[model samples]
Target chain A: MGDEVSSNQQEPEMSQLKPDPIGRTALAVEITNRLRQMILEGVMQPGEKINEKALTTQFGVSRTPLREALKVLAAEGLLELIPHRGAVITRQSEAEIAEVFHVLAALEGLAGELTAQVASDAELAQITAMTEELRQSYAQTDRPRYFRINQAIHQEILAASGNDTLVKSHELLAHRVQRARYQANLTPQRWRAAVEEHEAIAKALAARDAETTSRLMRDHLLQKLTSIRVKS
Target chain B: MGDEVSSNQQEPEMSQLKPDPIGRTALAVEITNRLRQMILEGVMQPGEKINEKALTTQFGVSRTPLREALKVLAAEGLLELIPHRGAVITRQSEAEIAEVFHVLAALEGLAGELTAQVASDAELAQITAMTEELRQSYAQTDRPRYFRINQAIHQEILAASGNDTLVKSHELLAHRVQRARYQANLTPQRWRAAVEEHEAIAKALAARDAETTSRLMRDHLLQKLTSIRVKS
Candidate 1:
């Protein structure tokens, strides 16, 4: 649940390896994470060709490792491998974007339900802390900073729900939509509305009302979808 | 959506191309579909190595196309690509399985909500028809037949929701878990209970009560989780 910084390595060094039998998996993960960040940050635009030869050379790895990394990204819905065209960054139509948010709403609703059912004091405390961080970022009118914290709070809810599949699928869909960037251009009014929803979500979690929490969560996600303009 | 089937690939030769060009993307997709079926049907087992050269010969494609297909599978969570180990089928831990189910529950719940919101009389009729099919199968005590219809009813609900992302994620997770065999092993009494739950789900959907539909869906999924052994 770390920020994009952890995922921003464009030319990861392959010189070093962790001392473990599963080190290869770790390296593959590093590659996947970095590629995901690059895509999300717009360094790699949607539908751009992924030149495997260039990637292999840039990462100082062979085609074998690079191929593995590409596969991992493809699974995350960040890339699509086009036959002779090779791997390309994923792009979504407006219809696809709408579909993603519809799913997200449902997923976040489930997260809210689970969070209400099982969020411990510590989990709640962590969420509260993120909410405060979001508030500060909002006050400073820093979009990227605010965006990071906002993303963290949403992710925190997903993790606290104790469902790995939901988290992974949610992240996959989110990535496919290039994260919508809806929250990035947050208007002051919408920011306040978002803050209010966070407060409601927190309160619902505290009360452990699954129904209310689920409803609030769905509403929260739908609000974001409505605010964001899907790219043509 | 349909049972994971082995593509016969024996269709009568069709026209060279349809109205649209046979885009590079389509070739990658066709290759990926074939590879996915292989893995799901256990033609390719967990940890079984995939040789790019061998696949190139088998699929009658170049290394570039084969590599792209591997990348596609890798993205679907069906194949794991190691740096040097190449690609292998994915295996899940018990914890991971539980995690997948938890997410499935949420996604299905979402489907239920949307189904209630948008499922038309025709869609409800379709589900009802499937329910009858299930009843007949259950009466015959043909577990496999019952399972197929059961899968259809659920997929129908997902499709009726009109959310592609939900359908895609739900289908992917369903394939990965492949819990039909486990469910097929349920005792007669438990099996009856499961069928009864399905009946309730069908009725709730027919009634178009969003709350009841969602609640029934969540409960149905939770029941399966509780009843199954969830092999470690």
Candidate 2:
């Protein structure tokens, strides 16, 4: 896993990569985002020890800032810092995975409830558009595209809630279990069910039914957990 | 706030303070915990710039590890690192406070549901005893003591949930709002209502009624938010 991540980074030098569009973001933030993406995308698999030397070489940075980024990710529960071994990608046990999904369901439910109350017509329309895109991905059986659009729709709901703390907390937890979620590709029946669930959630949001929207969102995420075959 | 925190630190010289028990924890973890305690206890006032010099002196550490700890706390939302300004204790707007409480309520609700399902008899007994102690503190009008006991009860509930991810997430959100929560002293009527609510939650947990327990626990925390007058 570490070697794959290292090889994938054989590209133009770090100086050649475009500077952050927002010049305000610090090096640590940029590095943290890159590492988090790699982990979530399974380029750095769960339970794999992070090769600090390789990462430093790949990013063309010293170990100091890279270590700082690892600390930040560790605090976010995406990495675990061992006493002597340094950092490793976090691996959730089956029970932990289930527990995370349960918590995510509640958080998403809160997002749906708040969004219904506060989302503007423009925001709702944006969500509707994302839903349409997700439907097309689903129809095309494009799993990766489906996943990306699905996340965007959920993220939009969180943003529409207008709760920065909620959004931040939700994003942290979402990132922790994202690899598992990415792997839990639905069976065809489950895929159909999920689409139906999304339809109901979108309808509730459109109608501004906070209670129904929250309930549907919560139930929808909870049902997603059932598709994961936790190893005994 | 700076003076108060400094005064609280007058007990011992940095060299005299005991070393970490395990001697294995990274300096960042130790520093993060100490700084987090200062912030959550309101010794370090919200938005106060963390005096890097003083903290480095107090902890007998170099700037490198201290800066790393600040980054970890920043990720945990207990501190914010501004561009060039360095790190300051986080300050949440009133809306952010309310949003945090709402998320806390949901997490606590899920805790109650899981605890009801799996908590050992001894764990439930521990919670009941904590409730009883909380009642005594309320009767004595010991607001600080009451607050401590109240937090302990909630912490115990989260612990009983047996979900590390849930507990970690809850603690992060709880610390972010700890100052506001500490300041939200209940009126006499609200105090009685809170005690009654805790009694109901305890009863439901004892009965192993997951649904009722979760609902009551969530409502109990949400009710606490009402006592807080958010600055408009």
Candidate 3:
């Protein structure tokens, strides 16, 4: 493995690299997405130093582009580039985690309020359907499926807000907060409460009750923050 | 002037450039600060292609660091890097501006609520002092001074919130939305109403009324949005 890594570290010409699969997307952007997914999914655990040699070999790219991708991720607050230590996935402190959740609650609440005002019937129907799906996942005790559905529902509402700036801002912080959230094992009572909160949120959306929807969304996120076991 | 411009354009080696006066700050970061100030002050107009060569000459730096600074600013949403066309200062559309203001209102509201809960006496006193200064500026019709003081008061509240993430997020959007705000000329009645709103906000802060303070802050921002004449 060491020999293979060393051989791959020999710099390859830029033209020899495979073309980006997504046309019009820059190579750095494509690399950034792949790295972001790895970090977000915990495949690359927080505080782990990114192995540039392995990553370059895995992606069949040169160091220049890979380093550039790291710079972009660092700028987005997903990674930290220490001068001599290279890049490490950032582990948010408990205080930082709480800070992120507080801001997210405000953003998601605003999204819910705006969606109520501007979402089309079709969009509202889609959110309602997702909520029902999430309910079924809960019933079946499929934690993974429930988590996916819950995220999708929140994302859909943000999209429905029809504000590009809000969506962008929310996604940036949400990406950082998700690692803590995924690790937080919700108790049975808290899980049930969350599901019921979703139900109320969907109902408010259906009724186009902007005030109630926003309030419910904000409170739901704040409640989730309490479930997180913050390390002292 | 042309001769002077040419003289400054004479290429200097990277090593020949002056060391950054801000100790330990990277060249790219210094460049980013200078560029951001230029764009914010309208020294570089919206949609104007960044003249890379001229900027390098002006900054007494090389193209590599200048381009890197442009990339950082682009990431901050203050500039747009068009493929092959070089970078241009971003011009927000009416919808985008409105969207940004809406999110800012939510973030600022959160700041007010949190600040009310946690602000130290000194912090509260500082805010109260800034409010008084702002009131005096309004009475004297010092629009520029009033704008500066208004921003300082808001900054104080965000600082008092004691949430780094909230302050970072609010400042990002606030920086982008400020150009539209500076151009908004408040009518006499609207100006007086704004001062009255600030008075109410100060009173709430003094009373430590979180709900009232949050609502007043949110409403104040939304009202300012109305004063902006969004171009069709």
Docking quality of model 1: it rates as acceptable
- Predicted candidate 2 versus true structure: per-residue lDDT over B25-119, tens digit per residue: 77888888888888888777765677799889999999888989999999888887876667766666677788899999989999999999999
lDDT of 3 by residue, A87-160 (tens): 77776678889999999999999999999999999999999999999999999999999999999999999999
Give me the candidate number with maximum DockQ.
1
C-alpha DockQ of every model: 0.32, 0.27, 0.20
TM-score, every prediction? 0.78, 0.87, 0.86
Better candidate number, 1 or 3, judged by TM-score: 3
Which candidate's lDDT is highest?
A: 3
TM-scores for chain A over all candidates? 0.81, 0.84, 0.85
User: Model 3: runs farther than 4 Å from truth?
Assistant: A1-24, A50-58, A82-86, A230-232, B1-22, B230-232
Kindly list the per-residue Cα lDDT of model 3 for residues B1-232, writing each as its tens digit. 2234233433444322443333566676688789998888877777667789999999999987677677667777998766556776776777788999999999989999999999998898888988999899999999989888988899999999999899989988888977888888788888899988988898899899999999999999999898885422
Q: Is candidate 1 or candidate 2 better by DockQ?
A: 1
Off by over 4 Å in 1: A1-35, A47-75, A80-90, A182-184, A229-232, B1-35, B42-71, B85-89, B179-184, B230-232
Candidate 2 C-alpha lDDT tens digits along A100-152: 88889989988999999999989998888888888899899998898888888
The fraction of reference interface contacts (C-alpha pairs within 8 A across chains A and B) present in each candidate is 0.53, 0.55, 0.40
Q: Show the lowest summed lDDT stretch of 10 residues, model 3 chain A.
A: A1-10
Per-candidate Cα lDDT values, in order, are 0.75, 0.84, 0.85
lDDT of 2: 0.84
Pick the winner on lDDT between candidates 1 and 3: 3
- Model 2: clashing residue pairs? none
